[model samples]
Target: MHIVVCMKQVPDSAQIRVHPVTNTIMRQGVPTIINPYDLFALEEAMRLRDRFGGEVTVLTMGPPMAEDSLRKALTFGADRAVLLTDRFFAGSDTLATSYALAGALAKIGEEFGKPSIVFTGKQTIDGDTAQVGPGIAKRLRLNQLTYVARIAELDLAAEEITVERRAEGGVQVLSTRLPVLVTMLEGTNEMRRGTLEDAFRAARTQVVTWSAADAGITDLTKCGLRGSPTIVKKVFAPSARAEKAHQIPTADLSFEALAEAVMGEIFARQPAIEGDLMRFSSGQ
Candidate 1:
């Protein structure tokens, strides 16, 4: 059961700033960390490998600096790492990102047998769109599982996997065949620290670096910004709100007074709210 986990190195949100002239995120001089969500996915894959007895591989697509993230994954016990970095891959939105990642996955499979499962973080902090994992599944034609909170069961021999997906209002427990892509939710488990031996091994390991052509991409038009449909025509920071909240002055922070003030405002603004309040007073 070989599992492939996709991870990304992202600029720390705290350190990120918008470039005044270009209207783009100013990534320079910002500390990078593994996308917070990706850490969960990596840990989950490692846990599954420990239980099912197989290898886990971590992959990332970013600037050359992202090699740091791949090496970190190795310290956590991934059997291999791959870096898909090239000038052409810059400014890629979800569609192009997915295409590039899928191509790298294919190359990894060719190098080390096919994987039984692919895992990814639910969403990247930098993108925050929660679309790439699904897009990758669509490109690869794998059964898609987003917001997977738990792996309920896995019958490797039977070629079936069951998982609990966190959905609005309820959980969806679905079963799908092998070779599925799962976007794992955060906080499932704590990330493990590498031992000295593991760290040494990771420092010595060479991550496979591939260009667009090396990954079997012959069509340049399908690999980067050209492949993306969504375009960011404008980027700007949110403007400050003009009006401030109305202050509720009170020497005594009494619950009844607070409730009365809130009700008064609601009733003044909305006649329907007054009627609802009356009905509530009369036990509906």
Candidate 2:
């Protein structure tokens, strides 16, 4: 019952800034934190480990500084931390990242025990593409579950897992065998604070570091910028609107009158919306 949790170090979105001229993210002077979404996955992994009596390993791919995130995971009761860093992995899009990570996961399985489950966040704050998890699953040929809200049951002897998956309009209860990948949704569970003993142990533990070669990635063409097909042509902040928000007076208005006033204002601002609403009401 080994579990692998994927984590990422990301710039704090609240403090992120875009270069005025370049229109690119200004990472300089920006503080980094563990991806908030990943925390849910990590906590869930730890919970499963606690229940199943197995080791939880935290894995991340980034610059050398990403070891900080791995160490942070260790403080949260992760048994081990692995850092996959290499110069060839720079500027990798989701495709290339999934390739590198899948290779690393294979290496991890060989060096450590084969993991029964791999966990990741729903998405990263910086990228927010929500593709890496699925990409990794596709490359690894693992059954994947996305937007999982809860782990309902685990039958270790049967090697099966059941979870509540968030879906459009409702939730889906799914059951799958071992060797599966899951992208955990945010706000499923709160992250726990590390104990003083855990923090001390994390400070002393050495993180396992692996380069591209160490992770068994040989094809340089499929690693970094060369492997990334997606190109970012432009990234700029949205321009401020010229008009201010219209305020509706409600000093003596009843609920019905207030509703009417809001509707009138919306229709006034966008006449097409009123026509669309009329058409919708008429079953058009």
Winning candidate number (lDDT): 2
> Residue 56 lDDT in model 1?
89
Local accuracy by lDDT, each model: 0.89, 0.93
Q: Any residue pairs clashing in model 2, and if so which?
A: none
Local error of candidate 1 at residue 124 (angstroms)? 0.8
Q: Give residue 46's error in model 2 in angstroms.
A: 0.6
Q: Residue 86 error for model 1, in Å? A: 0.7
Q: Candidate 1: give the clashing pairs.
A: none
- Expressed as tens digits, the lDDT of each residue in 1-284 for candidate 2 is 78999999999999988888787888999999999999999999999998888889999999999998999899988989999999999999999999999999999999989999899999999999999999999998888999999999989899888999999999999999888999999999999998888899999999999999999899989998999999778767889799988789999999999999998899988999988988899995
Q: Estimate each model's TM-score.
A: 0.88, 0.87
Candidate 2 error regions (>4 Å): 242-284
C-alpha-based local distance difference test score of model 2: 0.93
Model 1: residues with Cα > 4 Å off, grouped in runs: 19-23, 245-278, 281-284
